[model samples]
Target: FWESLLMQLLLFRESLLIHLLLFRESLLIKLLLFWESLLMQLLLFRESLLIHLLLFRESLLIQILLFRENLLMQLLFFRESLLTQLLLFRESLLTQLLLFRESLLIQLLLFRESLLIQLLLFWESLLIQLLLFRE
Candidate 1:
């Protein structure tokens, strides 16, 4: 009976050592899986950041193009407005010159009429003096 009990105790110790080794191996596998999951998460984050950077660059380019177009449109509008003002100024100057010409023509006509009336009065007075001398 003593020999049998000793054999059973040795067998039990060996089985317990094997169980401990399996538990340690399972723990190592769990740790390795957790590290792999963390690496995958990091890679995904890096990819997301790169995508965002590309999008921002594209947006910046579009904004620059829009601003240039707006500036060109404004310049065109200014040119058109300046041309219109110049035309209006030219028309106004022409109108003033025409009015001055009309006034000069009217003044010349009035002077001519006054000279004709003075000549007629001189002829009539001369005729009356002749008739009195004959009588």
Candidate 2:
């Protein structure tokens, strides 16, 4: 009976050692899988950041092009407005010159009519005097 008890105790100790070794190996495997998952997450995050930066750069370029186009349109409008103003000014000047010419012509005609009336009066008086002296 004493020998049988000793053998039983030795077998239990060996089985306990085997169980501990298997538990340690399982824990190590769990840690390795966690590390791999963390590395994959980091790589995915870096890739997303790079994609976002490229999209932002493209959007900025488009905005700059639109701003330049708007500026060019404004300049074209300004040039057209300036040309219109110049044309209006030229027309006004021409109209003023034509009015002045008409007024000057009217003044000269009035003066010529007065001179002709005086000449006609002088001729009539000379004829009457000559007729009386002959009678």
TM-score (all chains, Cα) for each model: 0.54, 0.55
Report lDDT (CA) for all predictions: 0.88, 0.88
1-135: candidate 1 lDDT, tens digit per residue: 988898888888888888888888998999999999999999999999999999999999999999999999999999999999999999999899899888888888887777777777777777888888789
Q: Where does candidate 2 stray beyond 4 Å?
A: 1-22, 105-135
In angstroms, the error of model 2 at 11 is 7.8
Question: Which residue pairs of candidate 2 clash?
Answer: none
Superposition-based RMSD of candidate 1 using all C-alpha atoms, in angstroms: 4.8
TM-score quality measure for candidate 2: 0.55
